[model samples]
Target chain A: MVAKRIIPCLDVDAGRVVKGIQFQHLKDAGDPVQQARRYRDEGADELVFLDITASVEKRKTLVEMVQKVARTLDIPFTVGGGIRTLDDARAILSSGADKISVNTAAVQRPEFIAELADMFGTQCVVLAIDAKRRLGRGNRRAETGERAANVESDIAREASPTGDPEVWFEVYTYGGRRPTGRDALAWAAEAERLGAGELLVTSIDRDGTETGYDVDLLAALAARVNLPIIASGGCGRPEHIYEAFVRGRADAALAASIFHFHRYPIPVVKRFLRQRGIEVRP
Target chain B: MMTRILILDYGVGNLFSLMSAIQREGAEPLIRQEIPPDPCFDGLILPGVGHFTPVSERLRRMRSAIDEVIERGTPILGVCLGMQVLFDRSEEGPGQGLGLIPGAVVRLPDSVKIPHMGWNRLHLVRSNPLLHGVPQGAWVYFVHSFYPQPEDESVVLARAEHGVSFPAVVGRDRIFGTQFHPEKSGEAGSLMLKNFLRLCRG
Candidate 1:
């Protein structure tokens, strides 16, 4: 049986590991190779390094950083963020990354995803979806402070919406700053249809909060998709990870803030999960 | 001096991890892009990644050098694409293999996913000294669209199942081949490499 995975995410910028609040206000963490070695020793099932600044002119820095980390770490590591082409994916994989995660690039050109899967195998291509709850007409004012429209024609349109509110999770690109208005669940299903072997779902609202995972959101999405779901965002403690496995039905839980701050070591978390009867690779 | 293992690099696969793994097992791995005229190594590792056609062509181009090393009875291990090249021929591309083993490499049946990637348990078949002490049913990492089908079943050391059970590990005396990558298979994989190194001692 396949054990559940515990992944530590490293957000890299300009060849150094960094973390931010809601993908902004970055702060230095430490050298990526050192951090990766620490996590591997602490029993991390896998590592995810997102070149958050790969989109900028300082892109070569990511390849160098990944090569450094790969040289030191023995476990599997995934590199993502700004992987726009097959050449970029090949470069990262050649640099020793076991898998490559794509977000913006995959959404813009869906065929690129399949082509990658064909070249590097489906298990190596992880599709990450950043999503947020779209404000409905009734809750529009609550979120955006827009005055309620009172026109008779506007009222009629609001009364009969196109779909269920449960299906209204909107897809966001550019690290959840741009809304695609596409249904998140629908997009996830389509991603699997397009040969994505795994799905990394990140909640825009709960990211970096360290409060807890959005269990309801993850559960709903996990229930709809058949592929392995890697729940991301708001993992503050060991119990939160347990909740993700049991309640959210996530096959793996990914954390950045708590792990980066040293609040929870991966070995301790894996031991706790194993004690609680959760099957994890030690 | 510690026994040195030579990793034959034909410009196809990643050799960094393979070199690291060999080092981790307490052996010195010398990565060579082209087979050297005077091979100075205890064992040889032919590592290849990607499509079979180009890899076969590249191996044939260096035929004299490769044959020289093999003729010396250097314990050789072929991984994935390299393993496919050890067979007589491959249906994947229009190139003949080195014919180190009597088999034909062909694409896996369409019933299973094209690239069978992920961890699968190995079922040991013929007990060989190369697999000495390695536990039965150990999970090893695999990533390939094609697998070698040996004409002689006795050479198959282990088998694994995806849609159907196929040869996962094969060997004929000093020449060993694995469809899965031991360098990337974690602790169990490292153990397998250690066992292969022990064969070099003899």
Candidate 2:
């Protein structure tokens, strides 16, 4: 039986691990390789390096960072952000990225998903969808500072899968700063059909909030797709991880802040889940 | 003597990770994209990625060169698409594989995910030097859809279940194949590489 994976998403900017990743033996917060190696030693099943700085000038730095991380860590690593075209994906993969995540680019040109999948195996392509719950009447913008695009009128809003009007979430791009107006669950299904190997669903409203994962959203996406769904956003506690699997039925749980701040070491979290009877990779 | 393992770079798969893993094991990695005239290396590693036919096409011209190494009983280890290319053919794309091993690479049942990506535990069905010190149920990273269905069942070294019980590790004589990427599978994978290096030393 495959065990549920616990992943720590490391944000990379300007060729450096941006945030302070305080592992039990974290040598430095700036060294992505050391931080990743520490997480691997602490029982992280996989890792994701999100290149927050997707500038053309920083692309070369990110590629080198990917190679360094690949040589330093043994766990499977996925690189996301700025992977817009096939060449972009190739540059990362050839530099030793096991899998790549395409968010805005895939949403803009839906065929980009299949094109990358056709080049690399589908398993190597993970479709990252940012979904945010729509409030009663406000559609201001995402606070994540991502660029906004006027895609709200592209698709008509459908009935929420849960059949609750207040529960509907619209898909967003550019780090959840822009609303694409696409139904979150509907768009996730479409990505899978387009040959996405996995769905990385992040709750824009809950992201960086660290209250807990959006269980309702994850549960809905998990129910709609057969592929492995990784529940991201709002994991403030180890129990939240357990809840993601038990309640959301997510195949994997990804958290950034909790693990980044050393609030709970990955081994401690895995032990907590294991004691609670979740099959996690030891 | 440093065990030298020749890694084939068919212009399909990236050899950096594989080469780095080999170097970490204290073995000399000899990489060549072009087929060499002599199988002078102590062992051979076929590291691959991409669709079956395109990758297989890269291996076609090097078939006779590869066969010469196999005929010499030089230890060879193939990972992912590299492992699939050892089979007679594949369902992924049209074309014949190297046919070094007797089997057809078939698509995994649709009941499970296509790529079968992630870290899955291995159940050792039989003993082999490649799995020397590795524990049973040791987790290894897998990322592929098709698996080799060897005509000879005894070739299976270990098995893992997704939708069905598929061969995770297969061995025939000195020819070995791991459907997963040993270079990326952490400690357990490193041990497997070390074991393969030991076989090369012999």
B-chain TM-score for every candidate = 0.95, 0.95
Give the local distance difference test score of model 2.
Answer: 0.83
Clashing pairs in 1: none
lDDT of 1 by residue, B88-129 (tens): 898877988889899898877666544565566788998997
Computed on C-alpha atoms, the DockQ of candidate 1 is 0.20
Q: Mind giving the per-residue lDDT tens digits that candidate 2 earns over A1-282?
A: 678999998878877776422211122246788889989999999999988784788789998998898877778889998789999998988888888999999988888999988887788899998888775323433333322343233234344555565557777787766776566777787788899999888887777777888888988887777788889988889989999999998888998877877989998899999999998889
Who wins the TM-score comparison? 2
Worst 10 residues of 1 chain B by lDDT: B110-119
For model 2, the docking class works out as: medium
Q: What is the TM-score of chain A alone in each candidate?
A: 0.87, 0.89
